[model samples]
Structure formats: C-alpha cells, structure tokens
Target: MSAPDARPVRGKRPKSGDPVVDRALALLAAFTEEHRALGLVELSRRAGIPRSTASRLAARLQAWGALERDEHGRYVIGLRLFEVASLAPRSHGLREAALPYLEDLHEITRQHVLLAVLDQGAALLVERLSTLGAVQVAYRVGGRLPLHDTGVGLVLLAFADAAVRAQALSELDSPAAATLRRRLADVRRTGVAVFARRRPAAVSSVAVAVRDGAGRVVAAVSVVVPVDAARPQAYEQVVRATALAVSRALGARPARAE
Candidate 1:
C-alpha cells in the first residue's frame, strides 16, 4: 500500500546521492526542438515526478539560471545553459576543426553547408553556413536531429560502434527507419553520404565523413545545393575532397585518400 504522499518516480533510479539534482536534470531533458517550452503540468508529466516536486526543482533551476520563465509562464532553457553546453569538449573541439573548411565549402558552393558531430546518439549541428538562397533545412547550429533521417546523421550512425547504432535504430518508427541499416552500410563502405532534397527535392545535400587522427569518423562535412543544379556525382567528388583536406587538418590519413 503506497501512501498518498509517496514520491513519484520515472526513468531509472538515481545512481547517486542528490535525488533533487537528478530530478532537476530530468526536467531539463524535457526541452527539445519539439517542445522548447513547457508548462508546470507538462514538465512534471514529462519529468515523471510529482508537480509539487517539479515546482521545487524548477525554482532551483531558475535560480541557478539554467532555465527561464516564458511570457506565458512556461519554462524554457536559459542562455546560461547554452553557455555551459558550449563548453562541452565534443562540440567545441569538432567545431574548431571543421569551421574553416565549412566556410570554404559554403563560399565555393554558394549554398547551405554544415558540419556536425554525433553527440548522445543525435546529430548535433556544430557549424552552418546558410546562403541567401539555401533551402530551409530543419536544423540549426546546436540543434539535434534524428540519426535516422538527416545526411550527417546517417554518416555519424555508420561510424558509431555497434551498440549506439542499434539503440538509435530501435527508436525510429517510420518504415524508412528500417532502411537506414542498409544506407549506413553503404556509407560505411563508401565513406560518403549523398541524399536528395530533404523537401520534395527542394535541395539536395552531399556529405563526406571527416575522420579523426585515429581513422574514425569524427564529423561530417556537407554542402546543400539547389535541386535544379544538383549533380550528385560532382558534389560527391568535391565534398569528399574537402572532407579529406579537413581530415588532414585534423591529422587523419585514410588509406584511400592519403
């Protein structure tokens, strides 16, 4: 028989002391591209804790400057969190290596270009160059997209160790999701990612895996071109070449391109 005031629980149990801290983080996890802001009830429901508990946790987060209250009284991540998140080594390190080349590709193609890294099983855009006429991609710098949908996502998934790859696939529900295993296999075999326009062939993206010093894919470099002018083979060639140059900048020497 549970008491009426018993503590609410969700996710796995806290592995350490500071249950409040874990609950606070769980609340933070509820904010995603799909829902950047959440009311108290929604937050509590998503966090899987009691509303009273979530209220206390939210106050702590707000005080710590990790979250802010919106005009409508919903809570959203604050600039302080972005500042803290930026210090993550994977984001800053990969951006440092890819920024220059991303700029070059953007200038040469006069289109949208991006560099992304795999983080926590999602493709996190680290750098982007959006031209005046580039198609509207559903991603932005620091944004996370499914590893089973986007071009960089596939390449990142391809290079990931087996367990991570399996986990990502298991989360997708669309029929196309099943196709990713084969797509990733092809990417692993060819070291490049080629895709048609993300929106009704509005624009197509060509991507190549950028390797790290250990010959492992660390990031992806890509160019987005208008569908009308898309030449998949030509784009593939240039992107692969640029990716190799960037890889060299990072001291990765793949046998095929070295």
Candidate 2:
C-alpha cells in the first residue's frame, strides 16, 4: 500500500535533555496517523534532532523492536509497540470486556460504534467499528476527542469527579463552559447523551456511560449515524443496552429494581 503523506507532528518534544531516552521517545512521537513512516531526514527533522543523532537512536530503537524499516527503507512503528500497548490495563482490559457487545452493536447498526475512556481531560478512543457504507466520521482509534463536544465525551465528563469536571471547565470559554455544564447535567439525569456535529459530514452520536464492578464510570460507548438517516434519539435505548452489557462483562452489578 502507498504510504500516507507526511505532516508535522503535534506535541512538543521532551525538554528533559536526556540523551538516549528522551530523544528516542521524540523519534517515536514524530510518527503520526498521516506520517506513519519516515526516512532518516524526515524523521530527524520531525523529531527536531540532528540527522546523525536520529540515525543512532533509530538504530537502537530498531534493535529493540520498537521501530522497524519497511520494504521502502522508511522507519515505521513496529508490532512490538502494539504488543506492549496491548498490556495497558485501561484500554486493553476495557476492550476485552467490551468487544463482544461492541461487535453486536456494530452488526445491528452497521454504522460506527466507538468505545472511549477519559484520559488527560479528553475522551481517548480505544476501539471503533465501522462498515464500508457507514457515514463518514473523523474519529480514529487512539484519537482524542473534546470532552465538551462529543457524545462519548459528554457521558464521560458528566460522570467524572467534580474536580475533574472543574478542571475541564476551566479550559473553555464562558459560553461554552455554561453550555457544557447544562449538557452534563442533562446527561447525568438522562443517563445518555445525544450529540450532533455538522462538520465532516452531519452525524449524530448516541452515547452512554460504562461502569465497573465498583460502580465507577470507566468508559463510554457510542454509535455514530448519519443525521439524515434517523433521529439520534432512536438509537439511545440500544446504545444504552449495549453499554449495560459491556458494563456487566466488566463486572458491574445490575441496579436494584425500585
């Protein structure tokens, strides 16, 4: 397959000035969704390191199986990195518990189903399932979505600790913060969030919170569908059911009947 175009990496390089570890991490961070592979010069430039330093670091990383060279001799993220990432309890454990229900939801909707967790004040997508004819959406697995703007995000933010919510609110403008406060209150009251976005193709997402055995909200499950295809509320019940199923799989207890 043809390599995607290269783009500037997003985050700042570490300022610790550690020769080996920090530079190595910078090299890895240089690779992104659009720039998955890079030649020596591009890698060095993107990592803000000298070519010679990048070559040495890349060689070490390649030896450690954290990076690998492709057929075209460009450096790409290695399978070993994924293997290591798969051990992360937050993402991997949730994925294992939620995959079955997520699959069922995907089969039923034949649209986009997403599982995400709150990380670093944003919704970090852990898994996404979509079909060929599904409506276009900008989200990708491992991407971060705004807590104030997305359905899954709203569910997560609403159930987050008050301190966490306050920290997130501090980042937004007054009007947006007020709007999000109102929306978060609604999510807590209704146990679901229906969010619509107009850009990147008009779509609506219905999301519900997933809880663990301890009754702490841990993740959010969502379904994204074309706005014109159906009303967002139509999917709320099903999505909530799916989230409940996944939560049970994760050892969450059923609520006592009133």
Candidate 3:
C-alpha cells in the first residue's frame, strides 16, 4: 500500500540540532502516496537530507523494522508501524466497539462508511469500509481531514469541546469561520450533518455522532456516495439509526422518540 500523507517534511529546523533525530524523521517523511518506494538518491532529495545521512538513517530505520527495501532496492514503509499504530486507544478501541455496526452499514449500502473522532484540531478517521463500486474519496483509515469540510468532521466539530472549537476557528479566515459556525449550528439542531464536494469528486456524505453512556459525543459515523447516485436525505435515517445502535452497544441510553 501507499504511504499516508508522504509529503515533504516541513517545520522550523529542529531546535535540538540533533542530526540523528532530524535525519530519521526526514527519511520517514520522504514517502508519500505518489512516491511510495524510492532509491537512495531520490529519498535523499525528497527528504532534503544529504545522501550519506539518508543512507545512514535508512539503514537504522530498516534495522528497526520501520522501513524495508523492495526487490528493486527501494524502501517502503514497513508493517511494524501499523502493528504499533493498532495500539492507539482512540482509533483501535473505538474501532473494536464500532466494527459490527460499520460492517452492517457497509453490507446494507455497499458504500464507503467511516468512523472518526476529533484528534488535535482535525477529524481523525479511525476506520473505513468501501466496496468495489463505492464512490471514490480522498480518505483512509488513520488519515486526518479538515474539520469544516467533511461530514464526520462537521459532526465532530458540532460536538467538540469549546477549546477545540476555539482552536479550529482561530485557524480559519473570518469568512470560513463564520460559515463553519453556521454549519455547526445546523448540525447541532438537526442531530446530523451532510456534506459534499465537487472538485475532487462529486460525492455526498451523511454523518451522525456516536455517544457514550454519559451522552458525550465520542465519535462520528458517515457514509459517502457518488453525487449522481446520492440520496443523502434518504441515507440520513439509516446512518442515524446505525450510530444509535453502536452508541447503545457502547452503553449510551436510547433517546425517547419525540
């Protein structure tokens, strides 16, 4: 599989001036979705590290199982990282509890189903299930998405703590912030959020929150469909029902019908 967010490593220079740490990170960041495997020269160029440094660090990373060379002597991300990432409580724990419902939803709709939660200031996708003919989306398990632009994100932002909301707003331009505020209000009022985008692909999404026993919104679940095939409104009730079932399984009380 391709690397996740394998963009050029960017930041102010590491304050500690630790060559080992800096070069190690640079090597890891060199892999992206489009450039999954690379030879020494390309890896060094992409990582902005000296060839010698990249070679040294790559050797260490390989020794540690963080990276492995392919048949052509190009490096690829190793399975060890995935093994470690599976221990993350926010994703793994919630995914374990929500998998049955997610499977049911996928079976019923044969579309993309996502489970996500707020991480830092973004929506962190914990799990996703997509069928062969499902609408294409630029999301994957363990990927981070913008808080205001995704269905799961809208639900998460709608129920996020004030501090997280504030942080997200502070980062947006005033116009965008205002639009997000309005959208969040709507999500809160309606108990669900629907989102769509046209640039990348014409797709629509419907999402709802999953609450814990204390009524705290712990996660969001969503479905994505091609715009031409979309019946977002029709999917709303099903998504909400699935979320409620998962929430109840996680110990949340059933809401009295209004």
lDDT leader: 2
Error of 1 at 13 (Å): 13
Candidate 3 Cα outliers beyond 4 Å, as residue runs: 1-19, 171-173, 254-258
lDDT tens digits by residue: candidate 3, 26-111: 89889987889999888988997777667888999999888999999999998887788788767897898899999999999888
Q: What is the lDDT of residue 194 in candidate 1?
A: 77
Arranged by lDDT, best first: 2, 3, 1
lDDT of 2 by residue, 176-237 (tens): 89999999999999899999999889999999999999989999999999999889899988
Lowest lDDT 10-mer window, candidate 3?
A: 1-10
Error of 2 at 91 (Å): 1.6
Writing each residue's lDDT as its tens digit, candidate 1 over 44-78 gives: 88888778778888998999889999999999999
Q: Rank the candidates by TM-score, best first.
A: 2, 3, 1
State the weakest 10-residue window (summed lDDT) of model 1.
Answer: 1-10
Q: Tell me each candidate's TM-score.
A: 0.80, 0.89, 0.82
Clash pairs for candidate 1: none
TM-score, model 3 to reference: 0.82
